[model samples]
Target: MGIVEMNKDGNFPNVRLLFDNDTGIDDALALAYLCACDHVQIEALTSTPGNVDVEQVAANNRALLALCERPEVPILIGAQDPLQIPLVTTPETHGPQGVGYATLPDRGTTASSEADAVDYWIDAARANPGELTVLLTAPLTNFALALRREPRLPWLLRKVVIMGGAFYYQGNTTPTAEWNTHVDPHAAKEVFAAYTAAAEQGLESEKLPIVCSLDTTERFEMQPEFLTRLAEEAGCTESELVLASDPEGTLSNSSNPLVRYLSDALRFYFEFHRHYDQGYIAHVHDYFAAGVAAGTLGYQSRPATVDVETESTLLFGTTVADYRGLWGKPANARIVSSNDPESGFAELLTRLGALARKLDTNS
Candidate 1:
């Protein structure tokens, strides 16, 4: 099928994205962008133990959705650790309690007690069959397990857009790999093989998965003016909203302004990155993945046999593709081709600002 066009009524394809997060700032930004889209319908979210604890991730998802006035969205907690490797979280980047140490509002949103991330994914895919697109923004462990449990998942899936694995760009987590895939190399290997097989068999249309790695997303940065405007439109000081989004505020009973600001601003990610890997203010990677899923960001795919090397510490968890002579498939995944981040951020500001204006007028 071609692009799922939004009808006159503004209804688009029903999407079921399974998130494996630890409540990082970019995750919140991505969730906000997803909720803002008019066509895409989010079916559910499954949190994992990557950036923070599973509980904290689930809470952050609910809290952010609530802030967006989308409390109807359901959140489910997923695996506490990867399928193989011991979980290594980036506390400095997301703060101690995830969510960049933002103070979250007192919203008693309950989480679904799914068997596991894998089970939840399997059931959702089986239920939706051939209509659901699985956008994995974190590790592929949950997805790999789900596929193992239900080997026919690819047959049911419409597409699988992942946000892991570095090809042409330097890795954020290591010299050869992205964090999500790096966390569970075994799972990543299985998932890559499964999807590649599906594509070769013509089970899925987009054989080459859309990967919004650091190389592309790092280019899209947030302008300070946009943050200032968002703070103004929210009818509260940016400091206040940031405070409300903090997880530690509820858990540790402490408050910090820098933490709160970091919780909401994707630009501040560099502060943590510099400490961990000598990185700087990168774009909101996951949110841009959502943008691609929504068909706004364009991407070109090169068809090649891709695999994840789970062995060799130097190459472990790294994804590599053999594209010696084959021309890869063209895709709609928009890898930012050196555009003005300030301009791109301005578009976001204007779009959200217009939305705010329309809401105010109706009120």
Candidate 2:
């Protein structure tokens, strides 16, 4: 069964989502999950530099879309670098090409649409006022820029979902920051500031950005056995065994291509986590964020005023959430407080497995 019970009727929620991502391994999984869902309507994809460079990130997005047989969606490239910071990519985490060991198919004719991502953000919001939900799984570069160009975005769009920040939780990028926010602390600061301004201007609470911080996102960890089960669900002839005890860099020999791609990609992630002593499981962060954006994941959120520290040398990218109204600012974000990662991952596997089965049968 899907997350929303209404989805059984076949035409309940027409989630019009605009994805803004850095196109890393987790980002690829997030997009693939949405592609598998029949109800989610992915309008466009915008690329931002984080796990890799802008050009590479755009390429990865096109390749993942093509791999899922979704080439119609236009990809828009954002600023090459953050608003104010040196761009640093984690090749060690996501591999040099940013998609781990998985190889993507050609992006057919072109890579991106003519629309500037920042401009597209403003135009798309104005064209479909209160009808589009923007999903940001990367640094808030394009969003901050868009807010700068169009100050009314907070009220114009239906909603905004962000997969960044650590709040009072442990940071993945630094001692006090998360990866997406750490990449562009200035941009994140500006984005939060924009929402605070909008809240002061009477922006509805429902329209506030839903933030999926690392605390909740880290709960959706991916194990090697999950890939094996996914392969079986995809109707693969061979058993997909990506055991950490086995030789490192072991590739999948599954008959299904989707299974192969996911296995190979996730194996690298598994290895990376093991190297960092986080176990052999991969923390599928963006997948949970994608689920939250689609409204298919059951979660509870609390209103908080979020801000990023961009100046402190020791805590440059730290994200702080004020739940006590101590900052005297209206809440700008609805921070995800709790969720069931088990059911969320189960939902993801079911959807992706069904999609993979359908693709192989159709092909």
Candidate 3:
């Protein structure tokens, strides 16, 4: 199949998205944004261990989908642990439940797809061929496993968007590594190498892979005032309206459940960041990666040979990019260097808010 062309409305084409996430607060926010947007059609959601365990990730995905009234999208459980290391979680940052203090209704007995995550990814790619965009927001274990099982996965994908790494910004895990890569350096290394090899063997450069590093994502900070505006514009005083009740029967004329859920979820994230980064703001890092895949966010990127350090005792998981051809390797990834967070945030809020109103009116 060829590229999924945009319709006459000049909006994004209905991109088929397969998301692999840890389902942390940020991931939840990203999911809400994705679900609210009209440009992409989510295919499946696969879980991994990062902010929480894989099981909890799946549960969160299911619960959030239920709240969004989109439980039709399948959830698939992924690797229980990293490829060569013990699983580590960041409960401190994302709270014990992985979504901060906000609790989602338990999707009791809500099961994921029986197929292994690796198999699901490979099969999805084969079915969609050149029309699948894979958004990876967690550790790369599933992706590595899938790539190993099927070497043609890279070429089959329309694009791969990674929400990890830090090219120039300080790392959030180690002084030199980001959390996602730090939790699974071996998997990250394997994925970079696989994409690099695929491109060197003749895959188109544009379809190689895109990395939304901390350098760019750290600039995106969700402000409380923005949330306030959303609430006020939606005719609600408190941002917790959507969080206070089940969305199915909630008065859709009041506010959007998507916006309410995001607002409620961000409270804990905002507090965490306030203490962690001395800023009372939440960074929805993964949202930019999704926007990049959707062609809604403009980014400045450059071709680079990006690699992850898997064995440096103190610097394990550090993203090493050969920006100057220092290692004499061809560029394999497009490292996003900059993006207008203000414009991006504006677009996200506008689109999501409009979606909420539409859903409300329909409801």
What CA RMSD would you report for each candidate? 6.0, 2.8, 5.2
TM-score winner: 2
Better of 2 and 3 by TM-score: 2
The full ranking of all candidates by lDDT, starting with the best, is 2, 3, 1
The candidate, 2 or 3, that scores higher on lDDT is 2
Error of 2 at 60 (Å): 0.9
Query: In candidate 2, where is summed lDDT lowest over 10 consecutive residues?
Result: 1-10
lDDT of 3 by residue, 154-200 (tens): 88999899999988779998898999999999999999999889877
TM-score of 3: 0.90
* C-alpha lDDT of candidate 2 relative to the true structure: 0.87
Clashing pairs in 2: none
lDDT of 1: 0.62
TM-score of each: 0.78, 0.95, 0.90
Ranked by lDDT, the better of candidates 1 and 3 is 3
- Candidate 2 per-residue lDDT, tens place, 1-363, comes to 112211233344778999999989999999999999888889889999999998899888888787788888889888889988899999999999988898867555455542478888788889999999999999999888889999999998997999999977889889889999999999999999999999999999899999999978998988889988888788887788889897877777777777888888888899999999999999999999998888788788888999999889999899999988998999999998888888888888899999899878877
